[model samples]
Structure formats: structure tokens, C-alpha cells
Target: MPTPPRVLTIAGSDSGGGAGIQADLKTMLALGVHGMSVIAAVTAQNSLGVQGYWELPPVAVRAQLDSVLSDIGTQAVKTGMLASTVLVETVAEVLADVTVPIIVDPVGVSKHGDSLLAPDALDAVRSVLLPLATVVTPNLWEVEQLTGIKVDEENRLRDAAEAVRALGPEWVLIKGGHLPGEPVDLLFDGTSEYRFAAARHDNRHTHGTGCTLASAIASHLALGSDVVEAVGRAKEYVTGAIEHGFPLGEGIGPVDHAWLQRR
Candidate 1:
């Protein structure tokens, strides 16, 4: 049998199994990739919110990256929450030499509005990490945080994507999930553009949507999809996951990573 496409996720661990590393790995598996991980931080998180987090030492982060890339190489990589400036730099340095397509979810906050990326790390992400990304996925909130470009309204969303694109990633996807009306996510490479619109499910349980979307994109790229095709397919998969999203704990629940099989 042919070996499964291998994918790597370098992100924080979400104890709730809703986002971060858990979500990324689950999305990879659901999309038919062999998921590998490098835990950059561990969070005390649940349906409610992020209570606290502790970043792994830079040395440990590097070690894990080396361990994965040295032997079980990945065809694609997805990065979620690297919680600190040091962690961001560490990940950026390691990923710089990797030739695989990288999908970076510039995770800035949790579903409950808790900050995940360190303020000090924003510059590192802009300078070091974004350059190494094949694509950077940032929600409206993150778009403002990273680029000082406010996506306060729909009209300015494209301006925000261009600002993020200016930071160096070959592609930028500014998710407009927080905006009113139907959810519209815009994906732009320097030249062309693609807009993905989905009927906004009224459900409030979309805790892992960001992580899942980025990993799904990485998985599609690993499967040989072009940038536009990968983003299109990832949007479809995430929409299905959101549609099947079942409520979990007292607060927000997770997107159903296994929604495909369950159907």
C-alpha cells in the first residue's frame, strides 16, 4: 500500500482536545494524512476558555522539530499557537529550511476571547515566521493584532489581507467569521484572489474552526492541490465540520473533526 501523506503540526496542546495541536492532528487524520506533532506549549483550556499556558523551552521545541523532520519527514506543515516570542522564533528558524508548504494559523486568541499569542511575539511572527509560510491564516482580530490593520467592517477586509500579505507570506487568508451576515473568508495570493462564502451556522460551538481549517489546507496541499484548490477544499471540509458541530461542555464545543465518517 502507498504510504499516507505525512503532515506535521507545531502548536500548543489544547487539553480540551478542541483546538491547537489536538484539532490540527484530528483534521490531518480526517483528511487522510499521517499526523505528527511538536508541542510548543501546553494550555489549561476547556470549553470555557484558556485558564493558563506554559510554553515549552526553546531547546525542547527545537528537539521535537528535529526529531520529526530528521526521520518522519512531512509533506506539509501547519503551525497554530506558538505562545511566546522565543517559541515563535524557534519555530521560524526550524521551518525556514523546510521545503514543504506551510499553512500558518496566526492564532491570536481563544474562542472565549483570551489572548494566545504574546504581544511581544507579534514582531517575530511578522519578521521571521510569516516569511517562511506558504500561507498565513489570520482571523479579523488577528489581522489587526499582526498588521495594525483593523478589519472593523467588511469593506476593509481586503485591505487587511493585503497588509498581512505585505508581511511576506505568499498567500493570506483573512477569515471574516466574526463579521455580520454570511461568513466570507477571502484568500489572496499576490496576484489572484478567491472568496469563500458559507451559510453561517447559527451554532455557537465552533471552538476549533481556525486550527481545523489550516490543517485541512495543509492536508490538501500534501495531496497535491494547488493553493486555490487547497483553500477551497479546506473551506468545504470546515463548513461540514461546523454544520455537524455538536455541543460539548457548558461553554463552546468543538467542530466535529470526524464529521465525514459519522455521516
Candidate 2:
């Protein structure tokens, strides 16, 4: 049998199993890729919120990356929730030499409005990390966090994408789920632009949407899709997952990564 395409996720462990490393790996599996992880932090999280988180030492984080890249190499990588400057820099340094697709989620806050990325690490993300990304996926909130540009309406998405693109990523995907009306995401790479729209799923169980989308993109890239094709495919997968999102604990639940199999 042919070996499956390998994809690596460098992120935090979401104890809730909804977002972060858990979500990324689940999405990878659902998309038919071999998933690997380098846990940069551990979160005491649940559906309710992230109570607290602790970053792994930089040395340990580097060790995990080296172990994965040196032997069982990956075709693509996705990053989220580094939580500190050192962690971000450490990941960026190692990933700089990797000649594969890199998807950066730029996870700044949890679904419950809990802060995940530290205030100080924002600079490192802009300077060191994003430059090496094949695609940088940032929600409106994160756009403002990184570029001080607020995107309130659909027309402003291009502006947000441009601002983020200036920071160095080859492509920028601005997630507009937070806006009113049907969900629309703008994908821009300096000149070209593509818009993906999905029916607004009124499900409140949309916890892992960001992590899931980024991981799905990485999976498709590993499967040999270009940036545009990868993002398009990822959007479709995430839309189905969102439509099938099911309630779990007391608060918001997770998107069903197995929605395809279950259907």
C-alpha cells in the first residue's frame, strides 16, 4: 500500500478535544492524512473555556519538531496556539528550513473569548513566523490583533487581507464568520482574490472551526492541491463539519470531524 501523506501540527493540547492539537489531528484523520503533533503547550480547557495553559519549554518543543522532521518527514504543517514569544520563535526557526506547505492558524483567542496568544508574542508572529507560512488564516479579531485593522463588513475584508499579506505570508485567508449574514471568507495573495461563501449554520457547536479549517487546508496541500484548491477544499469540509456540529458539554460543542463518515 502507498504510504499516506504526512502532516504535522505544532500547537497546544486542548483537553476538551475540540480545538488546538486534538482538532487538528482529528481533521487530518478525517481528510485521510497521517497526522503528527508537537505540543507547544497544554490547556486546561473544556467547552466552557480555557481555564489556564502552560507552555512547554522551548528545548522540548524543538526536540519534538526535530524528531518528526528528521525521520518521518511531513508534506505539510499547521501551527496554532504557541502562547509565547520563545515558543513562536522556536517553531519559526525550525520551520524556516522546511520546504513544504505551512499553514498558520494565528490562534489568538479561544471560542469563548479567552486569550490564547500572549500580547508580547504578537510581534514575533508577525516578524518571524508568518514570513515562512504558505498561508496564514486569521479571523477578523486576529486581523486587528496583528495589523490594527478592523474588518466590520465584507468590503473591508480585502483591506484586512492586504494588511496581513504585508506582514509576509504568501497568502492570507480572512475568515468572516463573525460578520452578519451568510458566512464568507476572503482569500487573497497580494493580487489575486477568491471568495468562499457557505450557508450560515446556526449551530452553536462550532468550537473547532478555525483549527479544523487550517488542518484541512494542510491535509489537502499534502494531497497535492495548490493554495487556492487547498483552501477551497478545506472550506467545503469545514462547512459540512459546521453543519453537522453537535452539542457536547454545557457550553459550545465541537464540529463533527467524522461528519462525512456519519452521513
lDDT against the true structure, per candidate, is 0.92, 0.97
> How well is each residue in 73-176 modelled by candidate 2, as lDDT tens digits?
99999999999999999999999999999999999999999999999999999999999999999999999999999998999999999999999999999999
Residue 102 Cα positional deviation in candidate 1, in Å, after optimal superposition: 0.8
For each candidate, what TM-score against the reference?
A: 0.98, 0.99
Quote the lDDT for 228 in model 2: 95
Which regions of candidate 1 deviate over 4 angstroms?
Answer: none
Clashing residue pairs in all predictions, respectively, total 0, 0
The alpha-carbon deviation from the true structure for residue 214 of candidate 1, after best TM-score superposition, in angstroms, is 0.4
Candidate 2: how many backbone clashes? 0
Considering summed lDDT, which 10 consecutive residues are worst modelled in model 1? 148-157
TM-score of 2: 0.99
